[model samples]
Target: MSNSDLLDKKLCEKLAQSASLTIGHDVLITDSFGYVVASNDPDRVDSLHEASLEVIQSARKIYHDAAAARKFAGTKPGITIPIIIDSIVIGTIGITGAPHEISQYALLIQQLAQIFLDFEKRQRSTTRTDYRKKNLLREIITYDSRSHDEAAICESAYEFGIDLNAARIAVKLEEIEGRHDDASEETRVHQAKIMECLLRHFDHPQDFVCPQNNTGYVVFAFGLRSIQPQQYLEMLQQKCLCVNSECLTVGIRLRIGIGFFSHSVETLRQSYENACFALKSIHAGIRNSTCLYIGDVVLEKIAASLPDGICSEISAQMFGRVMQAKNRKEVLLTIEHWFQQRFNFVQTAQALHIHKSTLVYRFRRIRETCGLDMYDLDKVLAIYLLDIRHKLCGQSDSRTSSIVM
Candidate 1:
């Protein structure tokens, strides 16, 4: 890259301000074209530091004493040093103070600024690579399956050194929402932080992540063949919990949906869809962070896929009286807790904070009103599916409660 390309204004501004703080003087940096690009003194920015141009031409330090400063246009009574990276002068840094007062810092400041420049160059290179990887991910995952070319996708994956042959787990993340406009600097900063945290946390060779448009990311992680799916999911669940904890420190509640492990690009797409379904399975009313496995959301996905007309017919046939019951909310809550506690009367009662007799009374009333055997597996399953449907659609009789089951 050219010397001007190395002059990142923000990086320059930050380094200038930091160095100024350390040395107790104003710092200024210029591009290769010898124009001031950043300065601790805002007024000096974009002003040509003619002395820096002299340092640039000589490729050596130039001291400007009071009389010398008067000769060069835009000169300050300090030292101007060329910032060299890889033996080439890319820019100039000028310390604004009397030459004798700050002369001791001339070499020290140039070395420090050059180090910062070298680090920034490496950082920018890494950022560009990450940007390419995310762009590739968005291309593969967001396109319609029919419209996407599998061959081209595989080729692009190979270019990025991604192994489509190895098994992988797809994860969808939703960390924040409605807090800032998607295009705002705040949103970008938060997204970058979360992505950086995830990349560090899942530092496996095969793990990759991409930020989604609005509020989240799509992550693909290497799948270990040594562990059972459930065991691996539990491990991933713990890792995601750690991520959530970190995000919470920043007031971000992270929600993640994990898909099952699978092989191949086609299966990868399916896994992505499963992750999406897992995300949808969550009740929007839940404000706390959560990480849900795809397998756990099968019933909810099935319920969600059902046509509205079918759901309506089933809802009417299954719980016509219960829907219109005077105590609809109570009955619904009771049913949900009973099923969640695995039909253990005492446990369910304890969960609901009601006496065992009172819990039985609710179940009895449910059976009578719904006109179905509450103990029957088919009847109970129907209720569960409809409950899931209601949750996914955000349809509720009262203010929606968190979907705990």
Candidate 2:
């Protein structure tokens, strides 16, 4: 919120409109770029506030008298001051009038804007508990187990009345595919609306939601003690499916990963890791499912859990040479889809939109190239795991605090 682009344009407009009334002067607001974003005078909106740059660069007040205004084009004799929030210059506010006449009003407006922004920051703090919650979630998920951070996290969770003894599952939602023409601010607004609706949908007494940067959201849902683990998981699956459908309606395709139920913050580390591993499997293109459980990931979980260097070594040993062989693309596609279909020839052929004979020929080439066969389950499992590891290596690492990206 302290960033330049995060400045609330509508709030600035309201400030300009409401403040202009007090002094009988045109109040104007400019973004960090010196583009007038809001003004009491409708025609002045979106125009360049020439003095904004000077004030912003100086991080101090800039005043232009009538004589200086007469010498400069598109100039108004006024006082412009930078709006600094959290020590970052987000934008500026200006009072358009005679420099001497509006000087007092300029100081008053600056103070008023600062007070308003401070109030807004506090509102976000207490209203949604957003600032505090985001920081806590980051700390809990990113810190090492058995560390001082865990004690702090527990204390903070206690303050929020989150039941540490109760079972809680961490669910992560990421927009895997989508396209939109919305500007940054509009996108932020829409995302906020989506989160609000999701918070309501995932409505449990102890459920807590915090957005992960702008790319995704992490939810820690509780109140699972009343239901069996399987039943609770089923209920969560349905909720995530519904949420995914709603997101699709707005041109967002999402992948949701549900972690295991855990009680303590120390174990929550595994839960968050489980969620990331599940998402990595989805991104690995082994399955087309919108939602996956960490427990159901099977060999993928075992394989993806390996260190990146080991995963790379296994992938290079298993399919790397095969992928570099002749007709590699067809072979790679055939082998991947073949395993995805559980070695069903017809299903693999249909998935690849190729004839059964072509698929057979591709398999023959794969066997010849890699000395591997689907009949050998050990080799096949290795390939399956290595393929997932290989694909995950190319995509973003879900483990390194994906919440921030």
Candidate 3:
């Protein structure tokens, strides 16, 4: 680390104050550039001290008596000690008094300065390490490995003790009800506590946790030997519920979404994307639920992977007339409930809280207006698939209307 970064002005002032109080003499602290950064005499601050420059160059302490002090500019009767860290002189500390009276305190002041400098150095090192870890996580989830050398990625993962071949799943956590934006400092503290709890609870050497785009937390957990995805997800769900229950008392709640298992680095990215999609699928109706899995919405997840234009085309062809009707939302809901109940008229009516005859009338209107054969198995499958696509992608009203050209 550079001298300016290691021994900043605020630290220099603190050292000067402590040294002055301990030795009962005025103290002056200078940077490597020979400028006084802190001093008991306020007028000396930011001024050049030529004698301290000579001490820095010689890498040794210089003592001058009252008679010898006249030879150097900005010099007083004192002992100037070089503040050395790791065999390099970073700054100088001078105690203004007779050489015989203040010379004993010179070593004590130098040791104190070295202590703080070492601490600052270590803090910078830790910050760099954290940045590298977060950067690696971001690249693993977003970078295209095909454009880079495969061996290099493997080597990088090895350095971090991450096994690329291990079975792992991505989990995402976010605040429900859109409460993240207005978070206060106290809320951020709770957020950090929640993240720390996750890291400790997982407690696997190969597992990783990091912030995702300042929005929420993401975790990548490597499964143990012979453990299946279902077992891992079940264990994680139980842990999340326990954590959520404890957090509720503190007025913070979280929703968790889990993706499918991935055994390779390439598929890990897809798993993370699936986790994000699952989290986004949560609506107001399911707000009470704390955990969601990608497997629960397989059809919607599959439709999300298809090209948007193709999904839109399929939706327009299958439900254009019904979506364009005066009561489009109601018609869509009825169709969704009918499919969800597996074409059982009584069950569908009960689910929707409507009379059986009313459901029959609605089905007849759908068949006439949309030109869909409800009883044909192939057409029924296509319509159900399109409905899932519409629910996931939220097809616009304008696109649902037939185009006139």
Top lDDT model: 1
Off by over 4 Å in 2: 1-128, 177-183, 307-321, 395-405
Where is model 1 more than 4 Å wrong at Cα?
A: 9-80, 86-88, 93-105, 115-130, 151-161, 176-197, 210-215, 228-230, 245-252, 284-289, 341-347, 396-405
- Best by the TM-score measure: 1
Give the per-residue lDDT of model 1 (tens digit) for 353-376: 989888778778877876656678
Model 3, runs deviating above 4 Å: 2-4, 10-25, 30-93, 97-123, 177-191, 283-289, 307-318, 338-381, 394-405
Q: Candidate 2: lDDT of 369?
A: 76
Which digits, one per residue and each the tens of the lDDT, describe model 3 over residues 1-405? 568567777778888988898889999988887888898788899888888889999999999887777887777889889988788888889889987788788888888888887787787877777687777777778758767555666577787788867888888888653355656776567767777778777778888777664347888877777666678788877776776676666676777778888887788888888887777666422222577788876866665566657756765665567556776667657766777678888999998899999988887886787666566646655555655555555545455522100
Global lDDT scores for all candidate models: 0.78, 0.75, 0.74
Top-down TM-score ranking: 1, 3, 2
Supply the TM-score for candidate 3: 0.72
Instruction: Output the lDDT of residue 259, model 2.
Output: 88
